[model samples]
Target: MEKTSGWRGTREIWIEAAYQALIESGIDAVKVMPLAERLGLSRTSFYGHFSDRDDLLKALVTLWQSKNTGNLIRQTEAYAETITEALLNVFDLWLLPDLFDSRLEFAVRNWAHTDQDLARMLEDADQVRVEALQAMFFRFGYDPDYARVRADTVYLTQIGYISMIKDRPSEPPGPRLQRMPFYVEVFSGRPVSDAEWARFRARHPVAS
Candidate 1:
């Protein structure tokens, strides 16, 4: 078996440093020397984890896909009895990226503008997300065509937020939470109950 202590720690440090640089500036700033400086390590340390700059970039993309798309797929596949519950399950994924790196999301998207291969990967990732949503709706007995459109609406709107660079509010889980019921209802083709909203609010508590 491969050893896991020191090498894993070192690789994670480099990945985290690169992630920070990618989000704060852009992919251009995610160089070995700069990242090593940020981590207070030697440039040679990067070589221990990665073959070169391209290798590091590929790692970043793999990290992103695993966190973002992977979790969304898992959530979409989860059980939900009501349309409200089903919608909430997927909506929760959208509201907070928890394990997903939203900043890295924007960074990679910006990077894709010039990279045909990255753009293609992004397109495939997007299809996967939409299909997952469509599957969720389909499981709820929604028409396939309608489910696809709803999926498109939800996915495209979220992407729009990143592409437009909309300024997120400082205090959240309030305004955003309040509007979620309407979104669920619109997409699921079912009315959300007051009790449902109350439950959602209770689950995602914010200070008054």
Candidate 2:
């Protein structure tokens, strides 16, 4: 175990250790003693930050809410000239790990299967995300009902893709990314112009 010399770590350190544990080995592995060990801190140090394991778990959920759901909504609201660009903005979450943590998302969703409260929160998050997408489409002058359906299609398809690939090794960006323009076209019923594609591609040079 790597040890930190003379370091008792901070609240964020403990929470981040807990977060990694939760994502890597599920909630069952996010215990104070183990986290302290992982951080090279004493078990007592964890209590200085969190009251108990439950408190740490709550903090983890809050982190997820802020990082994943919050960023998704923000992406939908990001400035874009055309609906295709708007959809591409949201797609940034999938391509950019900093924008959205898919592993953390998958971990929390699996954890939710056994926790009723978390399951409800996950449902609320899904609704909030879909509504954000709907609003994005609406801003581009799509009819309300059609916007909702398109939003559902966009959100559900991404969720399904996440679920399907959760356990697989990360693939090269080129294969999947090549399909994104087609996906944007399908989602927004608009073709991506060369300029728009170039802008999006520049943001993700790995796909070039």
lDDT of each: 0.80, 0.90
Candidate 2, residue 165: lDDT: 71
> TM per model?
0.89, 0.95
Summarize candidate 1's per-residue lDDT along 80-131 as a digit string, tens digits. 7777887777777755768455677889998898789999999999999999
Candidate whose lDDT is highest: 2
Residue-level lDDT of model 2, residues 1-208, one tens digit each, is: 3546665668898888988998889989998888887877887788777789899999999999999999999999999999999888998999998889888998999999989999999999999999999999999999999999999999999888788675678778887788899999898888999898889888888843
Q: What is the RMSD, in Å, between candidate 1 and the native fold over all Cα?
A: 3.8
In TM-score terms, candidate 1 sits at 0.89
